[model samples]
Target: MYKTSTKIHLYTVRSQMRPALLLSMTLFSLLMLSSCKKGSPGSVNDPGTEPQPVADAAFLQVSTSELNTMAIDNKNVLWFAGDNRGAVSGLGNKNKNVSFVRVADQVKSVSVSDSRSMIIKSDNSVWTSGDNGFGELGIGNAVSNGNFVKVADEAEQIEAGWENGFIIKPDHSLWASGFNHYQIFNSSYSLADVVDTYQKIADNVQAISVGQAHVLMLKTDGSLWVCGQNVNGQLGTGNNTEQRGFVKIMDGVKAIEACSYHSLIIKTDNSLWATGHNEYGELGIGNNTDQNRFVKVMDNVSALAGGRFFSMAIKNDGTLWASGYNNQTFGITGPDQNKFIKVADNVTAVAASEYHSMMIKSDKTLWATGSNTYGEIGAGSERSLSVFTKVKLK
Candidate 1:
């Protein structure tokens, strides 16, 4: 048996700059117990004694939108910040030189879109905040909200896209609302009539990823399905055709990610594969040619993420590798990276948006790079950064 004990502390820091930039921070202290290793039944210590839980590791995980960032610490406290123009509320500010402030409380997880945010609280209820243009907030109407509003109950996971919101129920079923552009909801509903409430799509879903106009989901049996726009073959259906409903594209998939016009998958064998727009070699296939079918990129990938025109992966050794547009958008200088290039080591988790990227180290410290327009990079300045910089937290 496995168990977890966690402690969460909220940290809010505001930039010294006028009209302060908000940064949300969560300090997670976790205690975890590993499952018992294989051993002879009568060779181990007395069965009467319970195994003690271990404090081996803890780290942060982050997700980003076009304008905001959200993070879940080891204790499941979700912290949020960015685009304060009525984009998100429940924020606490600090008068300091820091560039981040903590917001929200008792959150278990979070996800963001271009202008909206969603979080699952400890009670298993889901809440939404920010832009609802097209009903992305999943609040049962096409109304925008600046403050967090309860949208659903008994949610297990949540995600937001360009203007769409998605939630997974306790039954491993998928649900969504918001913009119907490219038929993201797998319905013939016109763009003029967007989904207002969380509508059911499919069941037995193990994971779901939302892109600008496309969406991907993984079934409990390791099957991959995709729907929506395929202008650049982002659906990986071996063709450039739009899909209104879920279509099986691959199997044995362990993880998946999507953004803008591309899709990525990590198989059970720890191999990385990609499909869709490669205008800037975001596929990391050693060329800028687009692919309609999934193509192998590398192996030994442990975790993966994709930006608008770039993708990032972490190896089993804790090293970070990236490919695709290498311009300022990639947080690197010089020519574009057609093949995976080692950028950093000891990275535990990563989150990528259209123009900026944020990562967490094994030590639980956060780092960011790429476009800093509006200080979304959490570097305390509007100037873009081409190299990773540690975000100072209070």
Candidate 2:
């Protein structure tokens, strides 16, 4: 009887071992399955699943009524802007208007630097042209020379206001000319005066941005100075009175932008402040009331752009935010409310025109929103959209 009982105990132990072995095998299978499902990072079994190649850095291609601008910062890529009436790409030397020369033929956009002189920075060195009506071209009123003529000494930076122009000298001084309806061009209180004012404050100007009727400057002291049309309180002076000269509006400004009727400034803290027309809630103040003083809109802002009647911004995390007039006429979606709304994710930089908006992602992909009446959005379609749509530029 003792032998039989021992045998029974051994049988029971064997039974338990079988189940344990099976359980171990099951766990191993699951681990293998998980590994197969996830695969290796950045590897794809199907070629179709691979991500499309994009440029290494962010850039933009913009077009105005009479000109186009292709702004690129990536060292490995070349930027090109085609003319509204021309087409040339990859055909060697055909009769196409797609070459870099198109940028020189028409004076679409111009940028100057105090150290570089006046560089059209477009396609060729052909950097100055257009109305020159106000000598805004800085080429001394040579009207018959309808084409862009190079200026001898380049400027540190150039700013084009509604009807005026300003240049920053190497000495950190400011020089300006053209229309100054509200003393914006008063020789006594012009660019030279601005440089003097900045000197008195122990601040050096680094950059300048001009709005339709206002001027904004960034001082080395991290403060923002504003002047010009204040009829709609776009000056952010805490009042609606027009400022004949530059006045300190806020401090710690890291970047600034100006629109046709509004202004925006981003502080070092990644916060945004906007003043001016709120007719479409462009100020993002939660209401349509005009803001004469700077008001906080959101945080973590990395980049921003303004349009004639709307605005857009990007956060550090690559999320895109837009507000104001999002109508078909403007190339975007709804203005839902007086607040910023996320439109897309993974955006790197944003650019805005009077009626369209464009963005470049870290992967070098481009996306657009708003109006496309003139192929400004580059979709070849003339529909207005609220959400972002990818742009195929190959």
Candidate 3:
């Protein structure tokens, strides 16, 4: 629980003190009051002193990670509900109110798709849980693991897709193992490859983002590479051709993210770009037309997240924005927002799942809005929240 008090307690002394001492005390009190920032309770400026600001009852410092179906907190705790299962057994076994459970301690990073979940441990080793029907676990078998199982070592990052898993090595090379039904593995080679273990895919890969059946990779030279199902022009290669291997799409890219059928990117100029299926206007280009090539959407984007048919972004000034399919029954607001619209201010991080969204503000507090049929809102109830609400992690 959080307190809503803004009153400051002051003390008065009966005996007169020296002019110098009284003046110093007054200055200290003023400093303490001025240092209080929103979301952070208690002043550290004058610790162990009288009339100190009350410490926050809920003191959890948080950063949120939404895996398109699951969410994690700064403490490596996992929150899940709805159709997705496995990965951290019993985390949401009941299927009612959202269950509060931590996956593992010291988790360096995590990733998930519609059915699979992956995590990189503190040892620089990779572990995976959930559906593995296509050898998505990269553990030399097609069997699934309800509990996390180690698959690789010295991994810097991990990403999961509908039927594939990807990892980045300490040397910056890329490795992948799983179902390549859409030629997401070897673009120029045959699609008959069935990887049972980690197989070298590419080199000089800096980052990766995978969606339903497609993927986007950022090369060390700031060039963007893409592959997989392009039925909706998700590859953004000017045609609806499914790539055999990664094809260079653009240059001067900084970050990229994808959802079920669309992709978003942030370029070096701090501008936002989008391409692919736009049935729900997920591209945020002021229309619902599918884009075969990248189109400029907004400017000054610092970070972003893409969901099933919607997108969320954080501007350089800490304002949160959302676009794409929205209606009175679900989504951010309006029947739909073809253009970006402000949602909140002072947001430091933002994440989007299939049908919901979450964000952390500068105050280190967590807030959520959108779909909550399975209690994904972290409010410990099944009631769907159409407006932002404080997630009670405590």
The per-candidate count of clashes, in order, stands at 5, 15, 2
Q: For candidate 3, lDDT tens digit of each residue in 1-394?
A: 2334445566775466777887778888776656563334552333323233232222122222232344555555554444445443323232333633344565667776656677777788887777666777787765653667788878887887667789999898999888766666665546776676778889999899887678999998999999888889888899998876788978999999877788999999999999999888888888999998999998999998877788888999999888877642133456777778888898887777677777777776667777666555565556666777666542
lDDT of 1 by residue, 1-394 (tens): 2332333443454456333233112211221111122222323334544434223223366887656677776776665556654465334221121145556667888887656678889999998877666777777764553667888988988887667788889999988887676665555576567887888878999999988888899999999999888989999998898887688987899999987899999999999999999989999999999999999999999998888999999999998888988756544576788789988888998888887788888898777888766556555556778888776643
Q: Identify the candidate with maximal TM-score.
A: 1
Question: Which candidate should be chosen as best, given lDDT against the real structure?
Answer: 1
Question: In candidate 2, where is summed lDDT lowest over 10 consecutive residues?
Answer: 1-10
User: Which model is ahead, 1 or 2, in terms of lDDT?
Assistant: 1
Off by over 4 Å in 1: 1-59, 89-98, 142-145, 184-192, 329-332
Q: Candidate 3: how large is its RMSD? A: 10.9
Question: What would the TM-scores of all predictions be?
Answer: 0.80, 0.67, 0.77
For candidate 1, the 10 contiguous residues with the lowest summed lDDT are 27-36
Residue 389 CA displacement from its true place in model 2, Å = 3.3
Q: After superposition, how far is residue 156 of candidate 3 from its true place, in Å?
A: 1.9
Pick the winner on TM-score between candidates 1 and 3.
Answer: 1
lDDT of 1 at 95: 18
